[model samples]
Target: MKKGTELSGLINKVKESPKTLQKISPIKPTKDETQFSFWIEKMLLKDFKLIAIKEDISLKDLITKCIKEYIKEK
Candidate 1:
């Protein structure tokens, strides 16, 4: 019975962790973005990630910039 009570107390503390974390860092505003996924060569993705890191931008941002430029040229 004592062990069961201690387990329930631990569970309650675990459930409260998210609230504590939210107080420390409020959630960011939602971005106008959606998930996009496609198959690419393994080495190509590795190179792309390296470029994105060097540019200090996200992979999605780099891809979006490229696509927008292509559309503008067309």
Candidate 2:
């Protein structure tokens, strides 16, 4: 198939399959919190994500809770 034909086919499939598309809600920041970004080791991040999934909490919430606990301990 030509490139344009292949692209149209994929587009039609997506248009016909609404169930395959998921709606993503935007995350709202708390009044006291602002955006913060940092880098972590790849393995560590993967482990944290797994823990969050197992706990049934969002990764952002898990990280926030961990930071609060560390601050309380110190």
Candidate 3:
């Protein structure tokens, strides 16, 4: 098939499809909390969990403590 024909077909199909509006939830940040996300290696995450367990602290607390120490060192 020609590229123009394929493109027109795709456009027509898209035009025939129904559109829906989605309801999104708003994020509210607390006094001391904000949301962030990043990727980490599997083994590194396992090691972090293990260290947090050994220290008898929540994973969040462990991460916060490590970040604070890192900033202090810098």
**Local distance difference test scores for all models:** 0.89, 0.92, 0.90
**Top lDDT: which candidate number?**
2
Candidate 2 local lDDT, 1-74, one digit each (tens): 59999999999998884675678999787677788999899999999999999999999999999999999999
TM-score of candidate 2 on Cα atoms, chains taken together: 0.58
What number of backbone clashes does candidate 3 have, counting pairs of residues 3 or more apart or in separate chains?
A: 0
Q: Compared with the true structure, what per-residue lDDT tens digits does model 3 show for residues 1-74?
A: 69999999999998996866887888666667877789989999899999999999998899899999999999
TM-score of each: 0.54, 0.58, 0.57
- Provide C-alpha RMSD values for all models, in order: 8.3, 11.9, 9.9
User: Taking the tens digit of each residue's C-alpha lDDT, what string does model 1 give over 38-58?
Assistant: 999999889989999999999
C-alpha RMSD of candidate 3: 9.9
Arranged by TM-score with the best first, the candidates are 2, 3, 1
Pick out the ten consecutive residues of candidate 2 with the lowest summed lDDT.
14-23
Better structure of 1 and 3 per lDDT = 3
